[model samples]
Target: MATLARRALWPAVAAAASLIAAVLVAPAPAHAHGVALVPGSRTYLCYVDGLQANGQIIPSNPACAAAVAQGGQQPLYDWFGVLRPDAAGRTTGYIPDGEICGGGTTKYAAYNAARADWPTTHLTAGSTIQLHYSNWAAHPGTFHMYITKDGYDPTKPLAWSDLQSFWSVTDPPQSGGPGGFNYYYWDTTLPAGKTGRHILYIQWVRSDSQENFFSCSDVVFDGGHGEVTGVGGSQPSGSPSASRSASASPSVSPSASRSASASASPSSPAGGGSGCTATWALQPSQWAGHFQVNVTVKNNGSSTLNGWTVRWTYTGGQGFEGAPWNGTLTGQPPNVAVTNVDWNKVLGPNASTSFGFNATGTAPASAPALTCTSP
Candidate 1:
């Protein structure tokens, strides 16, 4: 009887141990809470995708709420929508979407469009328009607005000259607490008798105090006539004369800037050694001496970089002297300097940093080769 009892006791102990192991190994339920615009919700019918549970789109469900309450997850809040007006007689709606995580960090998303059912009668030539904007998110930030006259291309951006005007929130930037909201009004006059379709582009930036940044949204506008009414106040006078002369200006190019920022991470060569990569901005020949050359370095390898060296050859320029602590160029043009970037030296896998130097001499029309070494 004693031997039989011992055998039964051992079997029961083994079963209990297995159950505990299973409980420990099982994954917690997928936490999917974030600010999502319900399709067909009230006056808006848009979808907010790719929202982060703790970072951007806080989970509002009971399970997520419970988890957050238990200090296991981050809480999220929704952003309210508002209107923004620019120098040109155009209005746009700014909506705060939730947050998303990319490249191991959280980024905010904002919805941009024209106000729903804005009276067209108020839109006249030379009419100074005031945009009544608002913010209803937990995080505080300001919205920037841009207007494109020839309409916008999702794949191809319009030329800089085609942009009618732009506006941004003023100093002492806007902010909001939990369930807090703000309203702002911007004033701009419409161009005289310039009747046609126009596209409005709006972007938001989180304040330095906040950790979130705004993601761009698609543009929308209502192209009606100057006969509608019953929205805001009357239009202003003295519309500026419209000009149609096509002139190419030396403004900054969006494609070039985006390419510089986006090309920070390049795929490693099939058989290359372990290290990071860096790229320099394209400088035009005429403006070479007075220009600043910005370079972005990204770690493509799996290892962490404690220190790195960026080497490049210039035909008309001098060699690098040294760089600032954060890789900023602080010396005169034509001389090479090493930017001492201690903060940037410790780059993790797939991380990137940007630094630049002023160039005195003209840049060669063609781009020079750049090499990076890890220490």
Candidate 2:
């Protein structure tokens, strides 16, 4: 984990600024809003890994600090916002191979460096897993997920030829979750017999805008189930904190919301003046008469720490199937509820988090409008 400080967004989005002597016609960015993939994106995990009890960030992980040195601290400050505003669904050929991680941005080029020692999530080979994406800004979009081909080496620069997408979904199912996290959720089946470590890449291309968000999540197919062991969590070295630094940047604080309600009005964060917001995606399950859901919530509030609650109604008369993990759930059919578990309930201004669940429905019908509330 690289140490980092909490960043406050310049609300109302960002104005194009000239920096690094790079002359571009597009406006400079201010608030980065898009996603934080779970188990976690590189920027998101590194941000968490670098945090200290005192809310300071000086990267402790060797890779994270190296990334900062290469890319500068600004990209880490805007974790959710790595994008190509001009990419019109072009992949492989469109983005330069080495620059994929940064979306070809000079500021985030360090992340494109070929190296090991980055944080990783552990999983079983060929397991079907749920995926979550945060909503810093909500827009209708399609998601594309890919994995590196077998025998591909992480030590080498990433190329488009080295990856093959396994999943491409358009507006998957999602729930309006709490804790400042409105997420988009979908299930993916890992390729069979995949062993060792691999890179899980994600691309979120918005239909409303040309901008597209990307992510690189590290995973090891070690039959460990869904346990994520790296960065702020555990470690492949069996240690939480690897190398430590005396001086750290300001820590990025995560906030959470307590409970949400089924309401007509959307839950927009109180980002002083700007309307920080949250959004949801809900799709029908491929399984027999089931529904999968995701909610992507944003935290652009004045407060640092927060909690949340999520509520909804099954207009299709469907009900939940079982208990969900990482949070608590209640109610049935028409009126449903879920609250943030003790662990995940925090968001930083312009930051986001995510959660998910499933229900009994052949196909997802129009659910009642949702409302997320905060602490």
Candidate 3:
């Protein structure tokens, strides 16, 4: 009778032990929350690029895809959680170099990569734009916006020394997120003369808790009006531009400046005179001292277009950084031409396609006008 009673208890004891072990090994959930929406942060934009109707994440952008490969999709699901639990508003010495974008957390470490191919927001220098910071878990806090030093290198790991506080707002107004995102938003002006590529670092310090949120927004001061590229999709509904206010802080001079110049309006389109048009754009270069440009070809004719060729001349002595993508490169730098690939040779009326290439040398302050021809 005693042996039978002991055997009956064994199963219950084993089941209890298993439950305890499972609980002990489970990963802790991060308490941090919130991220930027417009001029989208790395994680936020990557999340947008990966999210699907079925609730599964599958990134298409090369940079976003690489980040997912390094860190599972959980980070994207918690896209607003690039934060530190005990930051207490500390900067510089607190977060280690090369991990500022990831908020110095291992969970978000994949976003710390120094690659330039991350999705980017395009804006004009000295322009006033609407700022949209996510409010996943609303709290009383102050938000600070910082810009990279003028000579900051985009291809290198971001460091505290590379940033300077430009705009700060406390307890801003909350509103429905543009494009279905919830956010605390305000308007601020970009620093003047900013060009090429730069990181807009956002830090939100909660007043009631020691937790803080951090994010990195890749942007180009290339005279754009809120157009985004490299993500390969449409932008959230609503305009990115906003009026400036006196309540916002004044702009400051940059500590240093890079040699590259920004295009006054990078997306200026050129008509081929044959109902075909080509517009040039800048993409993240991902290489030290290099930049990438994409040319979008469109057919405005009423009929189907069989083939097209686009040609341009760089005004800033820019040279090709690598082989062209989605098209064939012919001719030399400063005066180059690109032809359609087999897959994109045909286009219906009003249809469009794009091709890009990486290049080294100074990026022009104004997009070089492109000439398109159809054969």
Candidate 4:
């Protein structure tokens, strides 16, 4: 009897050990997040160009190809996270020269190399246009947009002094999207007298943490309107004028100075005029630079809300940490949209489901605005 009991115990113990090993070996979830310039950041455009029918990436642009070949595809996988989270908002003394495009990180080192062959967006010089910054996730703080001075060389590494900031806004407005690709939109005058190829360097600094994001968008001041070349896409996506939700950018505020306290008008609600009603409350776990909100979405229609989406704007600059139930939470502060996940798409008449997110910013005194829709 004792021998038989020991045999059974051995098998049970072995099974338990295997289970523990499996649990311990499970892969960690992807936690990468960051911003991409919408004419598409270098990584973003290349990512768009490289996306395959099977969903794997294979770079078609020469620069992108070389970059991947040099750094492997992991950088592109976290295309938005090409940042040094500890930048402390420093421009030159901290980040070495030539590494400005990649924020002095090794993963994106290839992007820092000087090369005129990178993709370029065509725009008119001194054009007053709304700029869109794709938020893979939202973060509070400020956005400093600078353009390389005219007579700048694209074939060399970008230097801090080489940039001339045209506009800066703190806690601007935003629009949400699916897949963590929300965008922050604001309007400003593109540098005038700029001709030929120039680099648009962006720095996103978070207020609560040292985390910061960086991007280098290549542009040419030409007569063309919203035209992007060298990436091989038939049409450019993510341009301010592109037909994307929450694409409109507010004109530069009269002050246009680098002030974080300015107010941004709420984004135009998504989902048409309206169908459903939404309410928001910032959860209790909020602090100086961070907070979370629970948005309760109600189905007002007589029939089931087979699918639904909700859009809102938080006047404070806020960044979401990840997708909510597989739905994308995107947009800069003052604007956000949350769509449904496959599992939670159905809502019977008068039914409701709550979606929430933890964001990196201070909560506004009032809920910005909400527009809910279904189809």
- TM, every model: 0.27, 0.57, 0.55, 0.56
Residue-wise C-alpha lDDT for candidate 2, range 330-369, written one tens digit per residue: 5556787666544345556765544445456644444356
Model 2 residue runs over 4 Å out of place are 1-30, 177-179, 236-375
Q: For candidate 1, write residues 322-347 as lDDT tens digits.
A: 22212434333343334434334567
Best by TM-score: 2
Candidate 3 lDDT for residue 106: 92
* lDDT against the true structure, each candidate: 0.32, 0.57, 0.67, 0.59
Model 4, clash count? 15
Over 42-152, each residue of candidate 3 has an lDDT whose tens digit, in order, gives 887776556442334577667888998999877876777898889999998899989999999998899988877776766678877767676667889899899999988
For model 4, the stretches where C-alpha displacement exceeds 4 angstroms are 1-29, 177-179, 233-375
On lDDT, who's better, 1 or 2?
Answer: 2
Clashing pairs in 3: 116-286, 177-181, 262-365, 263-365, 264-365, 321-358, 321-359
Question: Model 1 compared with the native: what TM-score?
Answer: 0.27
**lDDT-sorted candidate list, best first:** 3, 4, 2, 1
The list of candidate 1 runs beyond 4 A from truth reads 1-274, 283-288, 318-325, 328-340
CA displacement after TM-score superposition, residue 299 of candidate 3 (Å):
17
Clashes, model 3: 7
Better of 2 and 4 by TM-score: 2
